[model samples]
Structure formats: C-alpha cells, structure tokens
Target: MPTTVLVAGFRGSMGQKATAMIKRDPELELAAVYSPHLETTDPAAYDLPATTQVFNQLSAMDTPAQVWVDFSTPAGAFENAQFALEHGMTPIIGTSGLSDDQVAQLTKLAKEQHQAGLLVPNFGLSAVLLMQFAKQAAQYFPDAEIIEMHHADKKDSPSGTAVNTAKMIAAGRKQAPETVENPVETIPGARGANYEDVPIHAVRLPGYVAHEQVLFGGPGEALTIRQDSFDRESFMHGLNIAIKQVNRLKGFAVGLENVL
Candidate 1:
C-alpha cells in the first residue's frame, strides 16, 4: 500500500508542487490537504484529486494520512507539526522560519510522541551540497560569510538555509575565527545578520528564485561555494529523498542533508 500524505498549505507554491509530486509517485498517496486561511474545503476548488480530503481547520483534520507534508508559513508550521505528531503522523516541514528554540521544542515533542519527522531548510540538492562543502571548508578556513538571495515573495529574511549553513560551519570549526572590527561605521547594519559568529547577507529580487553563496577567507585567498535554484523543479529531488526517508528520522530533525 502507498504511504498516505497530508499536505498542509496546499494553496502555496511549494505545497502545490509537493502535491503534484505525490500524485505522480506510485508509493505515495495524497490522502488530504490543509490550508487554514482558505475557506473552500472542496478539493476540486484547488485542482486536487476528488478523492483527497480538504481541511481548513486543524481541529477538523482527522484523516488517515500517515505523513504530514508542510510548506506553510513560519507562524503556522509549529502548530501544524505538533498537530501531525499528536495525531500520530510524521511531519515533513519545508518552511524555513522556525528558530532554534522552536525546533528544539518540536524535536522534544516528536520524541515524546515517538514520531519521526523532518524540518528541511532547503530542498535543493545544490544547496544541500553547498552547506556540506561550506562545513568542510570551515574546518580549514574558519572565517566565512554567507549571502542568500531569494525571490521578492519570500517572507523570511536571511533564509533558513543561510542560518543553517552558519550553524553547520560553526559545528565543524576547530576554533572561533576572529573577525576584523570596523573602527568607524559608515553604516550601522552593513555587516548583515550574525549566526554563530558568521555574517549572513540577504537579498530579495524579482528575478531570483533561490541562490546562496558561502565565502571563506584565509590569509592568502578566499573560496566561494555557490548554489542556485532557478526553478522549483530543482527542489523536488531532495524533497522526494526526504519523503522516502521520513520514517528513518530521529524525532524532528532539520536539513535534507540529514536524509541525504
């Protein structure tokens, strides 16, 4: 039998893409869809399968879905994941606004419920590889900066990928690398956001889909690792990998790299 899936935020771009992928996959079943902000509960309204159940309220979501695939907003992600776990469904979260504390809370909840779930920062293989390569380089370089670019529609700044990359690099570093302090500040916030001592710059533009660069500077030269997602198709492969490996997760884990 195919694994049943409940796609939260079914009206969103990533959610729609996930729904299509699930339908195309023989091993996965689109049992239900949830979009709290949408009033229409008819699957046909969203161009979803007629047999698929539609839900607008969390309290009313009692379906046979074994997996909860979420691409909802940061505001709704935590509640959705908790609901999935409380109802004995694994959550595959693709949303990127969750803080470290929120992730920790969800991880604890997943363990208490004995459920395996994932919170992925980026579902693009190139992005995942970039993070890995950056972590590896951090050991030798130790000093680095991150720049993430996304579409103007993206709600979160700095992105989950950039923050994750910083944390990953921090974990791999042998020692804390000292940064050159600017004695005179021409601009107060010119250095960008800091995560684990690494600076992250965020850029939002109309033409961009998703792109990121990890720059490592040493005494002699600097290294740059870059990844680009020109289209949504770039993420599907890693998302598929995450879906197939969901049950193998240890509680609520972050990154598609965990499954990779």
Candidate 2:
C-alpha cells in the first residue's frame, strides 16, 4: 500500500505543486487536504476531479493519515503540526518564520511522543548546500555576515534560512571576534540584525524569488558562498525527499541536510 499523506494549506502555490507531485508519484497517495479558505467544491467546481477530500478544519478530518505535510503560514503550520503530533502523525513542516522558542517546544513534544517532526526553513538543494559550505568555512574565517533576498510580499525579514545558517556557523566556532571596536553609525539601524554574533542583511524586492550569500572574512582573505531559487520547482525535489524520510525519524529534525 502507498504511504498516505495529508497536506495542509492545499490551495496555496507550494501546496498545490506538492499535491500535484504526490498525485504523480507512485509511492505516495493524497489522503486528504485541509484549507480554511478552500471548500470541497472549489477544485471540482473548476472541472477538476477532487483527488483528495477538503476540510475547513483539521480536527474535522477523521481519516487515519500517516504523514501530515505543512506548507502554510507560520502560525497555521505550528497549529497543524501540534495537532498532528498529538494524534501520533508524523509532520513534515516546510513553513518558515518559526521562532527559536517555538522550535524548542516542538522538539520537546516530539521527544515526549517519540514521534518525528521535520522543520525545513528552505527546501531548495542549493540553499542546503550553501549552509553546508558556510558551516565548513566557519572555522577558517571566524567572522562572517549574511545577505538574504526574497520577494517583497514575504512576511518575515531576516529569512529563517539566514538565521539558521548563522546559528550553524556559530555552533562550529569557539568564539566570534568583535568586528568593530568603535562602530560609527550614520543611521540608527544601518547595520543589519545580528544572529548569534553574525550580521544578517535582509533585502525584499519585487523581482527576487529567494537568494542568499554568506561571506567570510579573515585577515587578508575572503570567501563567499551564494545560492538562488529562480522558481518553485527548486523546492519540490527536496520536499519530496523529506516527506519520504520523515516517517523514519524520531523527535524534531531541522534542515534537509540531515535527511540527505
């Protein structure tokens, strides 16, 4: 039997794409879809056969779904994940903007239940590789900064991927030397936000899909690693892999790198 999966936020862009991918794959089956805004007739009203049942509320769904995939808003994602975990269902979370405290709480819950939950801030393989490269270069430079660019409509600044990268780099280093002694500031907030002693600059523009650059400076040498996601398809491959592997994991796991 195919693995049964329930996708929340089924009407959104990424959610729809994931649904199509699941439908096309032979090893997965879409057991249900939950979206507050979408009704049961919405998909069929457009002359599309409903491959999965739609529910306005997650609690209303009675099907025994094995895996729950979240591609919804930050708050919605958390709520859906909590419900899934309480019900003994594995959750693959792709939502961004989750805070450190929230992540810790989820991790604790997963441990208590002995269930697995995955939180992936960025699903693009290039972004994962960028983080891996940054982690490797942290020891040599010890000083670094991040610049993240995303579409203007994005709700969160200092993308989660950038924050996670900074945390990873910080974890690998013993100490980060202060970059400036007497920092001069022409403006009040000219310098970007600092994550774990690393500076992070966020750029929100109309044209950018998602892009990030990690720069390392030490003595006379500098190194830079960059990644870009030009289209939504960049995330599908990683998301598919996470969905398949999350069931085998216990407790909370962050990043696609672990699964890879």
Candidate 3:
C-alpha cells in the first residue's frame, strides 16, 4: 500500500513544491493539506484534487494518515509534529528555528511512542553532500567559516544548513577553530554568529534561491565548498528519499543525510 501523507503549511514555497512532488510519486498518497492560513488562500490555487480537504489544524481532519510532512513555521512545526505523534502518526519536519529543548522533547516523545520521526534541517541533496564534505575537510583544515545566503523572505537567519554544517565541522576537527583577534568593530554584529567557535555569516537578498559556502584555511592553503539551490525542486529528490526511509527508523533522526 502507498504511504498516506498529510502536508502541513501547504501554502508556503516549499510546501507547494512538496505537494506537487507527492502527487507525482506513485508510492505516496496525498492524504490532506493543512495550514493555519488556509482561509486566506483560494482552494483553486492549489494543484490538488477537488475532494482533498484543506484545514487549519490536524485535530479537525478526519482523514487517516500514517505520516505528516510538515514544512510549517517554527511556531507551528512543533505543534503539528506533536499532534501527529499524539495521533499515532510519524512526523517529518522541515521547518527551522526549533530550539534544542524542543528537539529533545520531541525525541523523547518519539522514543516513548516507538515512532520514527525525522527533523531535517535542509533537504537538498547537494547541500547534504556539502555538509558531509565539510566534515571531512575540517579534520585537515581545522579552521573554517560559513556564509549562507537565501532569499530575502527567509524567516530565519543563519539558515539551519549553516548551523548544521558548523556542528559537523566542529565534530570532525581536532583543535578548536580560530577567531579573528584584535579586530576593529566599527559596527557591532559584523562578525556574524559563532557556532562551536566557527563563524557563520547569513545573507538575505532578492533573486537568490538558497546558497551556502564553507571556507577553510590553514598553513597558506585554503579550500572552499559551496552548495546552491537554484529552485525548490532541488529539495524534492531528497524529500522523496526521506518519505520512503523514515518508516524504517527506530527513533528520531535529524538531517536528510542520516537517511541517505
């Protein structure tokens, strides 16, 4: 039987793409779509069946689903996932901005319920590969900085991809990464945010989809790794993979790279 999937945040950029991708996949069923702002949008605007229900919350829906693929906002992501877990459904979360405490709580809930939950920071394959490559490169370079760029409308700074990359690099390195010393700070907050001693710079502007670069320096040599998402479709390939493999997981897994 095909996996029954409900998509939350169906009106957002990524949500719309995910809806279309799920419709095209024969192995998955588009069970329903949910968004708190559903009333403000037109149903005809979506490319779903005329019979499909678009509700504001999971509790209001009567349709049965085994998994909920949530690309909602940070505020809604946790609530949606928690509702799914409570209803005996697995949750696949793509929304960023969830705190570590929230993740820990979700992990504990998933473990208690014996449900496989997936919380992916970024779902683009090349992005995931970039992170893996950065981890491998960190051991050699040991000093790195990240610059992540996205469309101006992106809700979060330091894209989850950049934070995850920094963590991976920190894990792989032997010594602590270096920071600029005696830097003249004419303007505060110019150095960007630091994660595990690695600096991450966030850039938001128009005409860019999603892009990130990791630059490493050591002993007169430097290496750079970059990943770019030209369109939302770049993330679909990995999302499909997650949908197929999440059912087999014993507990919660973060990052699409874990399943890949």
Candidate 4:
C-alpha cells in the first residue's frame, strides 16, 4: 500500500521539490499540502491532484496523511511537528529552527504518545557523512571550527548542518581547555558564533546552494572535512530513506544518520 503523506511549506522551493518527488514515487501518495503563508487552500492552485487536500491553517487540518513531511520555516516547524505527533502521524521534520529544549520536549511527547518520527538536520547523504566523519575526527583533534555556506535567501544563520556538526564534535571530543576571547581585534564578533567551544562561521552567497567545512587544528597541522549539496535533489535520497524506515522507530529522534 502507498504511504499517505502531507507536505508542509508546499509553496517554498524545497517543499515544491519534495511534492514533485512524492508525485513521482508510486509508493508515496500526496494526501495533502500545507502552508500557513498561502492565501488559498485550493489543491489545484498548488498543482496537486483534485483529491489532494490543502490546508492553510493548522487548526483546520483533517486528512488521511500518515506521514508529515515538513519543509516549513523555522518559525512554523516546531508547531507543525508537534501537530503531526499529536495527530498520530509520523513526522519527518526537515526544517531546522528547533532548539535543544524544544527537541527534548518533542522527544518526551513522542515516547508518551508512542509515536515515531525524526528531526533531520541535513538530508544530503554527504552532509550526514561529513557530520559522522567530523565526530570521529573530533576524538583525535579537539580544537575544531566549522564554516557553513548557503544561498543568500536562506533565513537561518549557522545552518542546521553546521550546528549539528558542532554538536557531534562536542560529543566526541575530550574536555576542551577553557580560554579567554581575544580582545585585541577591533571587531566585537569577528570570532564567529560559539557552540560548546566550537566556533561556527556561516556564509551567505548567491551562488552557493549549501556547503559546510569542519576544520581541525593541532600541532601545526590541520584537517578539513567538507560536504556540498549543489542541488536540492541531493537531499531526496536521505529523506526517502527516512520515510521508509520511520515506521520502525520507537520514538522521536534527531539526525538523518540515525535513520540511515
């Protein structure tokens, strides 16, 4: 039987691509599409089948969608995933604005409800492998930094992949020695954002799709691990993997590698 799916943020670039991928897959059914920003709830307007349900308001959503594939904004993702969990739909979250606390709360709720889902940082297999490789590298080189580049229109700074990479590095590395910030620089924030002692630099440019590099330095030597997603299609393979394996999970979890 085909898996019924609902796509949030259907009007956005990534969301539109996900919708098309679903349509092309015979095993997946496009049961619905949603976007709070959309003016019309007409499925036809969204280039969906006439039978596909459309929802502009989360409060009004009533569909047969068994899987909630969210490519919504960071602002809307938390609530969207929460709704999916509450409604007994397995959520495959791709949007990345959720805080650690929010993820914890969702994790708790999922276990209580006995629902299964995932909060994926980056769906590109290369990105997932980069994060995994960075974690392994962190064991040997404790001093590390990350630089992430995305398109100019990307709203989130320090893309989820960068943040996840930092977290992975933090998890694998030994205790980092405390150090004071350099006061010599005239610029106040030139050092970039700090997460668990790992510095992350985010670059926004017109030509970049999504790219990240984790650099580690020690004993006058350095190692760099990088991944690039030149096109949105790069993420489809991992998302497809998540969608297929989510039903086997016990509760809400984080990371695409977990599903892989």
Candidate 5:
C-alpha cells in the first residue's frame, strides 16, 4: 500500500505544491487535508478531489495517516507536528522559526514514539548547497557575515536559513574567535545582529521572494556564495524529496542535507 500523507495547510502555496507532487509520485497518496479556516462541509473546495476528506481540526481526522506535511506558520507548526506525532504519524515540517528548545522537545517525542520527524529550515537545493559551501569556507575565513532577503510579509526578521547557516559554520569552526571590537560612529546598528559571532543582516522588500548571500573574508581574498528562489515552485522538488524520505528516517533530522 502507498504511504498515506496528510497536509496541514493544504490551501497555501507550499502545501498545494506538495499535494500535487505527492499525487504524482507513485509511493505516496494524499490521504487527507486540514486547514483551520476550511469549512467542514467543503474542505476539498480548493482543487483537491471531492472524495478527499477535509478536516478543520486535527481531532476530526479519524483515519490513520502515515505522514503529516506542515507548510504552515511558525506559530502553528509545533502544535500541528505534535498532534501528528502523538497520533503515531510522522511529521515533515517545512515551516521555520522553531526554537532550539522546541526542537529538542520534538526530538525527544519522536525518539520516545520511535517515529520519524523532519524539520527543514529551507527546502531549496541551492540554499542547502550554499550552506554547505559556507561551512567549508568558515574554517579558512573565520570571519564571515550573512545577508538574507525575503518578501516584506515574512514575519521572522532573521530567516531560519540564515540562523541555521550561522550555527553550522559555528559548529564547523575549531574555536570561537574574538570579533573585531572597533566601534564605528558612522551609523548605529550598522553591523546587524550577531549569531555566535557571525553577523547576520535581514532584508525585507516587496519584490523579493527569498535570497541569501554568505561572504567570507580572509587576509587578502574574499569568497561569497549566494542563492535565490524566484518563486515558491523552487521549493517543490526538495519538499517532495523530503516527504518521500521522512518515513525512512528514524528520529528528528534538521535541514535538507540529511536526506540529500
């Protein structure tokens, strides 16, 4: 039997793309869809098959689902994921902004239940490669900064990709080095926020979709890696890959690199 998948935010762009991809894939099946705002009578009004079950609450889902895909907001992700895991379902989290403490808790739950869970900060392949390159470059440069730009409507200031990239670079380094303490009066707050000594700058603009640049500076040379997502479709392929691989994973996994 094919793996049954339930999408939490089935009406959103990411969720819709994932649903379409899951329907096309041979290994996965769209078992159900859930959205808080969806009407109980016509939950499948948004292009889904009329036979598909529409649920407004997680408790309303009676049938067993193998996997639960979350493309919802940060505020809703943890609750949605918890509901799935408690019900013996695997969770594939595509939403960002989950804290370290929350991740640890979720990891513990996944381990206790012997179920798999995945939290992907960024689901773009190019973004994952860019982070990998940054990790390698951190050792040589030791002094680097990241700039992330996204749509103005994005709630989080520092994108999850930026935070994860900084953490990865920090972990790869030998030791924490002292940052240059030169105080410049040219402009206040010019340097941006520091994530474990790695400066991070966030930009929110109307036209931007999602973009990031990591710059590493050494004695005389500098290297920069950048990735851009022009549309939501850029995330579809990676998300599909994650959905297929989530069941095979034993515990919690962060980032797309683990599956890749």
Candidate 6:
C-alpha cells in the first residue's frame, strides 16, 4: 500500500517540490494538501489527483493522513507537528525555529501517541553526509567551527544545519573541549553564535542556494568538510527517504541522519 501523505504549505517552493516527488513515487500517495495562500476546489489546480482533498487549515482535514510533511514557516511548523501527533499522524517537519522546549514537548507527545515526529534541518543527502563527516572529524580534532550559507530569503540566522552539526559533534565527545581564543573585534557580533563552545557563522546572500563548511583545527593542520546545494532538487531525495521510513520510527528524531 502507498503511504498516505498530507503536505502542509503545499504552495511553497519546498512544499511544491515535495508534492511532485511524492506523486511520482509509487510507494507514496497524495492524500491531502494544506496551503494558507492558495485556494482551489479543483485538485487539478495544484497538479494533484481529483480525489485529493485541499485544506486551508488542519481542522478542515476531515480524514487523517498517515504522514504530515511540513515545509511551512517557522511559526507553522510546530503547530503542524502537534496537529499531526494529536491526530495520530507522523510529522516530518522541514521548517526551523523550533525551540528546545518545543521539541521536548513534541517528542513527549509523539511518545504518548506512539508516533514519530521528525525535525529535519536539511534534507539534502550530501548535507546529511557532511554532518556525519563533521562528527567523525570532531573525534580527532575537538576544536572546530561551522559556517553555513543560504539564500537571503531564509528566515533563520544560523541555519538549523549548522546547529545540528554542532550538537552532533558535541555528542561524540566524552568531555567538552576548551573554547578558542578569538582575535579582538572592533565591531561587536563579529564572532558568530556559540553552540556548546562551537562557533557557528551564518551567511545570507542572494546567489547562494545552500552551502555549509565545517572546519576542524589541530596543532599542525586543519580539516574542512564542505557541501553545497545548487538547486532545490538536492533535498527531495532525502525527503522521499524520510517519508518512506518515518512510520517505522516511533519516536521523535532530530535529523535525516537517523534515517540515513
């Protein structure tokens, strides 16, 4: 049987890409769509099957889907995930800006419901491998920093990818490493945000799609792991994998690395 999927923010770029990918895969089915902006009674209006339901809100979805794919705004991500869990649907969240407390709450909810809640920062397969490589490198060189670059329209400052990488590196270490001494800056905020003593620098520019570099330094040399996504298609492959495997994951998982 095809896995039923409800896509929130189906009109947006990532959402649209996910929708098309889901439709193409024989293992997946488009059960419904939720978009706050676009409205249409006809399913063909969004290139979906006529049988698929369109909803402006979660409450309007009369039938519960097995999976909820969220690529909406930060404000909408948490609510969509909660709604999915409450309705016994697994949520695969692609949006950022969820706080630690909010994640905890959602994880608890998923546990109670015996469903999975996934918060994926970046669904690009190469990006997931980059994070894994960074974790491996961190074991040898504990002194490291991350720089993540994204398009200017990105809502978050430090990309979730960078934050997740830092956390993963921290997890691999038995003890916290000493902080690096920085050169004095004439301007404040010159140094990037610190996550578990790891510096994260975020760059938002017009031309870049998505890029990340993790640099680790020791006494003699430094190791750098970099990955770049020139287009949105880089993410869909990993998204498809998540949609297929989420049901088997019966608790909250933070990254696509878990599925990989």
Clashes of each: 0, 0, 0, 0, 0, 0
- Candidate 1, residues 16-55, lDDT tens digits: the string is 8899999999998999999888878888888888999999
Please give the range of 10 consecutive residues that has the lowest summed lDDT in model 2.
40-49
Worst 10 residues of 4 by lDDT: 177-186
Models, CA RMSD each: 1.1, 1.7, 1.7, 1.3, 1.8, 1.7
Off by over 4 Å in 1: none
Error of 4 at 240 (Å): 0.9
Better of 1 and 3 by lDDT: 1
Off by more than 4 A, model 2: 39-43, 46-51
Model 4 TM-score, 2 decimals: 0.97
Better of 3 and 6 by TM-score: 3
Task: Report the error of model 3 at residue 230, Å.
Answer: 0.4
Per-residue CA lDDT of candidate 6, range 15-77, in tens?
A: 889889988999999999887766564788877898788887566667557989998998888
What is the full ranking by TM-score, best candidate first?
Answer: 1, 4, 3, 6, 2, 5
lDDT of 2 by residue, 68-174 (tens): 99988987888888888999788888878888888898999999989999999899999999988888888777899999999887888888899999988897776
Backbone clash tally (model 4): 0
The regions of model 5 sitting more than 4 angstroms off are 182-188
Report the backbone clash tally of model 3: 0
lDDT of 4 by residue, 193-229 (tens): 9898898998999999999999998887999998889
Candidate 6 has an lDDT of 0.87
Q: Between the candidate structures 3 and 6, which one is better when assessed by lDDT?
A: 3
lDDT of each: 0.90, 0.85, 0.88, 0.89, 0.86, 0.87
lDDT of 2: 0.85
